[model samples]
Target: MRNNEMHEAGQGVLEDGHGRRFYYLRLSVTDACNFRCDYCLPEGYRARAGEAAPLSVAEAATAMRAFARLGTRKVRLSGGEPSLRADLPDIIAAARNTPGIRRVAVTSNGYKLPKVIDEWRRSGLDQLNISIDSLDAAEFARITGHDCLPRIRTGIDRALELGVQTKVNAVLLSDGATERLQQFLDWLRDTPVTLRFIELMQTGDNRDYFASNHLRGDTIERQLIESGWQLLPRAIDAGPAREYAHPDYRGSIGLITPYSRDFCQSCNRLRVSAQGKLHLCLFADAGLDLREEIRRGDVAALAERIQTLVGGKAASHYLQQGQTGATRNLSVIGG
Candidate 1:
């Protein structure tokens, strides 16, 4: 797109050496969450919660403004649980107000959204990705360590009733993942919410957990196909997910098989930690410290510097079993 057209579409317009434009920014507002998912947060992470404080809403807004200037068209707020932040509406408002940011989305565990769903909708939340790993109440409790399925269902229903575009993200991270996924699909037969199956990432620092529960997303997709589900392609999509829909179903199914398939050549996003560290890839160890930079310096100059460094983004993440991944887990990485 031309400069004017790019600006019109909220396409930050900055390009790398491969001609890829970074239009999406996954910004982690806070690293705190209410639930302790087995695959995400380590067992002892919550017990030792003496880490440094996260950035304030205003501080995050400043960094977002600079990111907008650098060509970020989409901003997705992610965290341990983004709704855990009291100032989430304000943060959404900041992204909605940013000139180059066309979309503002959030990823949450869906336990805290029912109370303030309308408030967040009013604050310009365009879409939501709710994490719902299982349909059975008991298993859900076992995975998330929270017996709050009723509350999560209530929040999801409330979000849908409020006319918010919402989707479900389920991580395939258990021995009976296929069975649970089939049950989850049965539960979604008449619903309109799109469900996306995410592969169990081995990036976290839990070898035992990875060994016991790491399910290959491709195997699951093939299982679904063998069971007569139609796996079709979407003309338009959001990210790495390949969307699919069954002929007789109202809702859709998608596969985010990042490990089985490589979609890095077209990857067009960056990650900003809750503390303002800029990350090029989810599996990379390198990052730019924007937390201190936000304290002082010209936003435009920072934007220019970041734009110049965009070319350094790795072509693909060399991820394997027991490989060194990002320093932090999914929560801290804003996944």
Candidate 2:
């Protein structure tokens, strides 16, 4: 099907046998990152390999335009650290101008966000999701292998000051990090930033670390509710996180259980890596290469390939069966 035909056919709505609509696209702008988080990348992992072939800004814009033409209305720019790309604002602008696209967001580690929050807003960014695994100074350094918490906090404050919808993402590891959940929550009580707790997924080169850090969402929620905070439903879309709000709080809480429980039946997003591969599922070991094909000016073939991949997507991820190790690390693929 041609891109416009696919858009009119509503084939890109990506409804499964269960009638769930997949309309979101997560696009990774770069694979390079500055931080070496233990859970995301193994300790002492080589930061540089042979120079990797990343998609050019124009190529990324082409894929985004094609996705938009096929009914994708939401696109989130992600990366090993998306902010590292100097042309990030341009990418956001291109996606914003794409047909059928309604929202443009970015997920960053927040190390360099304080300086660019204003530019991001001016460039048509609708939202920002910052990854902050720990609030404590020393513990955060241990988790991210960097002393960037202060800068990250400043970036969050800047986002709030600029009136951007912001969310703080934290991953629950088996290192007893959940014990400090209340501390993080209390610190954010006065801010408008929502807190999201993510279960450590079994991916990348950190199998041993993930195996030790896997914490269930139910346990974390029960612990928080018992600590005198009320949890209320706050999910506005059909994404993985189950969001909740508390009485007398300025923000809310989001819990994502991709490993403990699979939400794949309602999975509505497609991931495009920095190398221009289309990943149907975050845990899938393989993906369809669209960069080369799209550059050849074959829009019809590209749309058909995407439809076939989505149709063949697995009902759920394999993490529940103790499976780990994807073809690429989370940084390269974009979570």
Computed on alpha carbons, the lDDT of every model, listed in order, comes to 0.77, 0.76
Question: Could you tell me the TM-score of candidate 1?
Answer: 0.90
Per-residue lDDT of model 1, residues 262-333, tens digit only: 567667788887877788888877667776667674566667667877778876776654554665567876
Q: Give the TM-score of candidate 2.
A: 0.90
Pick out the ten consecutive residues of candidate 2 with the lowest summed lDDT.
5-14
lDDT of 2 by residue, 215-287 (tens): 8877887876776667565332435777777777788888888855546665778898888888877888676
Which residue segments of model 2 deviate by more than 4 Å? 1-12, 16-18, 44-52, 225-238, 297-300, 325-328
TM-score of each: 0.90, 0.90
* Candidate 1 displacement at residue 47 in angstroms: 8.4
Q: What is the lDDT of residue 75 in candidate 2?
A: 88
Q: Which 10-residue span in candidate 1 carries the lowest summed lDDT?
A: 4-13
Top-lDDT structure, candidate number: 1
Task: List candidate 1 segments past 4 Å from native.
Answer: 1-12, 47-52, 227-237
